[model samples]
Target chain A: MARPTIADIAERVGVSKGAVSFALNGRPGVAEATRARILQVAKEMNWRPHSAARALGGARADAVGLVIARPASTLGVEPFFAQLLSGLQAGLSRQSVAMHLMIVEDVEAETEVYRDWASAHRVDGFIIVDLKVRDPRIEVLEELGVPSVVLGGPGRHGSLSSVWADDREAMLSVADYLAALGHRRLAHVAGLPEFHHTQRRMRALRDSSRRLGLAETVSTTTDFSDAEGAAATRALLSRARRPTAIVYDSDVMALAGLGVAGEMGVRVPDELSIVAFDDSVLTRIAHPAITALSRDTFAYGRRLAEVMLALIEEPERRRDVKTATPRLVVRESTAPPGAWQGD
Target chain B: MARPTIADIAERVGVSKGAVSFALNGRPGVAEATRARILQVAKEMNWRPHSAARALGGARADAVGLVIARPASTLGVEPFFAQLLSGLQAGLSRQSVAMHLMIVEDVEAETEVYRDWASAHRVDGFIIVDLKVRDPRIEVLEELGVPSVVLGGPGRHGSLSSVWADDREAMLSVADYLAALGHRRLAHVAGLPEFHHTQRRMRALRDSSRRLGLAETVSTTTDFSDAEGAAATRALLSRARRPTAIVYDSDVMALAGLGVAGEMGVRVPDELSIVAFDDSVLTRIAHPAITALSRDTFAYGRRLAEVMLALIEEPERRRDVKTATPRLVVRESTAPPGAWQGD
Candidate 1:
């Protein structure tokens, strides 16, 4: 496709190429009025900057780096990260910002990567995911003076800009939905215990149960693996007083729990109700499609990328992006407990 | 953790720093005996090359690029790519070769990205996936003279080095397995028709059926989405003579097919036998645990990265790595046709 170039914008605006360059680069030479006119013409011509040219010109690295601090095997199963990455790439591509993605073994290795990227100027900024409870990355990035945007939090991140879904609110809504469905005893198969969002969601689940005066609530931690999820379901179901409804922290885990239920001959929504967090194809395609906490993950990623750019370009300004709480999408999974038995 | 530096290796070997540098850089000054000793010392000390330092030294980029051509939504659901990426990352990390990953919209855009990365020298080479028949990328990469290794192929790819699983052999094994179970009629729900592997597998399936003298065989294609897989299954099952056994191209799609079967009150193995490709957590977690073609995708990715590196480091080399054929992991999903009816 023949995309509009700076020369085209310059020709349309009747300005010299140098003047257009000054305007585009936000340099001091172009008059304010001339800059506005050039920008308008450029926008009209759909002139997108080429990252390589910009990189060569020494104006910007035209790239952002994201270091995922997790084993590759763990990264493989989690669709959230992939979806978020896709959104980030889509958003960054619009501005011609390359995404430098890397996976690391731990926070220590992750910090080392941050240091390396910063020292090398390999990226203009970073997008931090899987924020831990006093995330070591915040301090490392701060010390390195690398512009960064955290993907999760409204809590303590030491002034770093963050884009986060309201995990607390989402958890509360999930609990509310299950409670309203005439469930008394409830169990939550939570994800990795250390993730800030996981801790936040667990707290929300406990607080909401207390606030709503639910009959019973139990929570179990997991590494978010399908096998672990299934094991957690089995453990929960075997308790002295089995929960009538169960909530899973991820779609895969929820699907696993459904399979476990099938193996155990516990009919869904009749003997028990199931709900899952983070909706995806797995949730939608299950035998009785799972009711899940639905959020726009792609949009969330796009928003985070935008924030990261803003943090990089406008260092003086700090922006916190908080996505609305994930809403409950009630499919076939959840129903009033034991209602079918009455029929 | 403090990794050993070149200085440490030099000190340990009782050699001059310059000699160590020469040996590590593969430069001419070091004597043959001295080079061997220095290399041995460096290996013992674990003095791995730092990519950024390597880049600044006027060496190659020390980075391999992998660009996924798919929408983010599609990328998220498919565990195969993520697992492959994990393996690639794990493999590349061993050699301290950075992975530059990106996602593009289509083959056309994917080609443009190749051009951009090559012209900018952003990557030393590429590990290409989702190979198409007469793939346009082969020619573009050839023209650019960019070192690349295609992930899937034993077919035409313009002499580019490729790493492939024997799709044909895997398909034949799958067909033979089903046929041996006394299923005369079979249906295959394949993924994305344009993918070279899909075509190869389809041909293999046909040829194998003919060789075995099976009563019937039918094939359908989908975009690899769960919805499409379910629809394809529905369409196949509604045929005048529904195949007793079915094969799916992915674990997610297979799980969806199972859900569809549940909806139709068609019992797995009892009423219909099902097989899925690319075993992962999804296949294992399903109600009856789908029988699938199991391969070490992580190792596959790792092998591809190693191949890409070899291609980049020695451009004159044309190395084709063929991974072992995926073997069938028998689970509860497959059984003799109408075996449950006798009970």
Candidate 2:
């Protein structure tokens, strides 16, 4: 059977092709009764609008693009990504906008996807995450002239609107809390050195260490996987001058670090303190319940969606939105440096 | 500035519109040098093919739809979903196929999305999850004649291809393992009652109870959130004849159940054993860890993606695929009933 077309619907409804198009597109030209009859005939004929034709007519795609350049395996275990995605979906779907999601290998592939989607008119706008230091994608997105919102940034993104939390301030608060507890030596298990937020956090810890006159403060970067987090913790703990407190960039890594501590016979809060930069159900349910910088990631996702919608509705009305800083939620994981015979 | 069109590229390159069209679409009839020159002109002019025109020309959308009907909040903490999504992305993106994702409120909303995407040709196919008993969506999909792969089902999907694990056998294995450990009184914390897998599991537990002559077996339905899991656990523990072993449908729920046991001073594997039907890093890193029905969710997702691609490529060749059944991995969470004076 041949697929039905607008002309076919027009013939069946005894209307002009232009009138059929107007009715199907919900334009103002067609009368209500005529439009209803045309729609009935169209449905009976199983006629579907060619999306490409709609695109040519300048109709909204009703979708947004989210392209991430992260390892698939690592992404599955990270609660932060899942929560953010769910939140993004919740907010976007409320506006009847679907999310066009993809995971690519590197920045080049990611940028290629952005260009392809833009050229295809596959999505109305784009949501950029895991903002990189001196990000190359920003330039590409800017050139594409597509409405986009970066999930990270107070200022680095050129012309693209952004929804960001103050990673630097959030990190500084953790350092201050640990320092106040008399933790002189500190170590951080940071995530992906190239990420803007990771760099911000690392810089914050260094600045805090210098200002507090700590003996030493070391920051180790990883791919935000539990294995890498555990390995980094092992290397730090195996050292002669081990830090008294260790902070992780994610709850999964923090949990892994805590397990490593147990395996090494170092009691949490008694011999070594632990902190997680991100919070979720995992942190709250752990036996020692690791301290974490808590923020509502789901709400953050909703905020990003709102920003993107506003940007798409009025492209000229671009703005940077700084969300609330994540505060440290102390649990059973942290303590003042106790008497340690090993050190 | 106005957007450039194919005519502009053709005029600039001194070629016919047909030659430019063929060259831009990577079609034949245009000489290699002419094709290259035409492409260069098109690029210089920043001309993009109208996606609608391409769609009208019968080009693939290069995307698949995945509409989930689960609550967004419950979805975030569930490792099963996150891992599956990551794996699906890994496989689909390898083929340069993006996923059109949405989280709807229920099956009605989900089916509505499928219809909309189908009518608009927004996606080449769909990957449906959380199959339910007497599924209404299957018939709708069949009528739409869109290629789709249901993520759960050995049967009950009419004229739709499916990729499924043996939930019945997986549950039976867990029951047998606990039965061998001398747990006569067993209880199950199942996911949404409407899901086909959940029904299968509930029936399997019932069958196991009868086959083994167990004293009592109870299965409580939940929304698959940690809150519901904890509440169910609390209710079960409050019973005068509390079961010695509890099986939870998900790791997040199991962790919450474990926390409930801890709060009630019911020692795991001693007073109350716990088991999670789904496994991830959470189950592995918990204090005592958790015995779980384990499968590679990431691999499962990749399998779904492969099936979807095959189905889309050859719609006539429909088949149901049965992946590896999840195996029971015994950890510190399960044990035989122990000495207890109070009970």
Measured against the native two-chain assembly using Cα atoms, what DockQ does each of the candidate structures obtain, in the order listed? 0.22, 0.69
* Runs off by more than 4 Å, candidate 2: A1-4, A25-36, A43-48, A339-343, B1-3, B16-19, B22-36, B43-48, B339-343
Error of 1 at B85 (Å): 1.2
TM-score of each: 0.80, 0.96
Model 1 chain B TM at 0.83
Docking quality tier of model 2:
medium
lDDT of 1 by residue, B1-343 (tens): 2446678888888888888888998999988998999888777654667544554444576578777777766666688887888888887877766777776778888888887777555778888888987688888887778788988888677778999999888889999998888888889999888899999989988997889998888889999988899999888777767788899999988998998888778889888999999998778767788999999898898888888878877988998888899999999999999953332
What RMSD, rounded to one decimal, does every model reach?
Answer: 8.9, 2.2
The local lDDT score (0 to 100) that residue A45 gets in candidate 1 is 62
Q: Provide i-RMS per model in Å.
A: 6.7, 1.9
Kindly give the stretch of ten consecutive residues in candidate 1 chain A with the minimal lDDT sum. Answer: A50-59
Q: Tell me the lDDT of model 2 at A251.
A: 94
Tens-place lDDT per residue, model 2, B13-58, is 9989999999988889999999999988888877877777788878
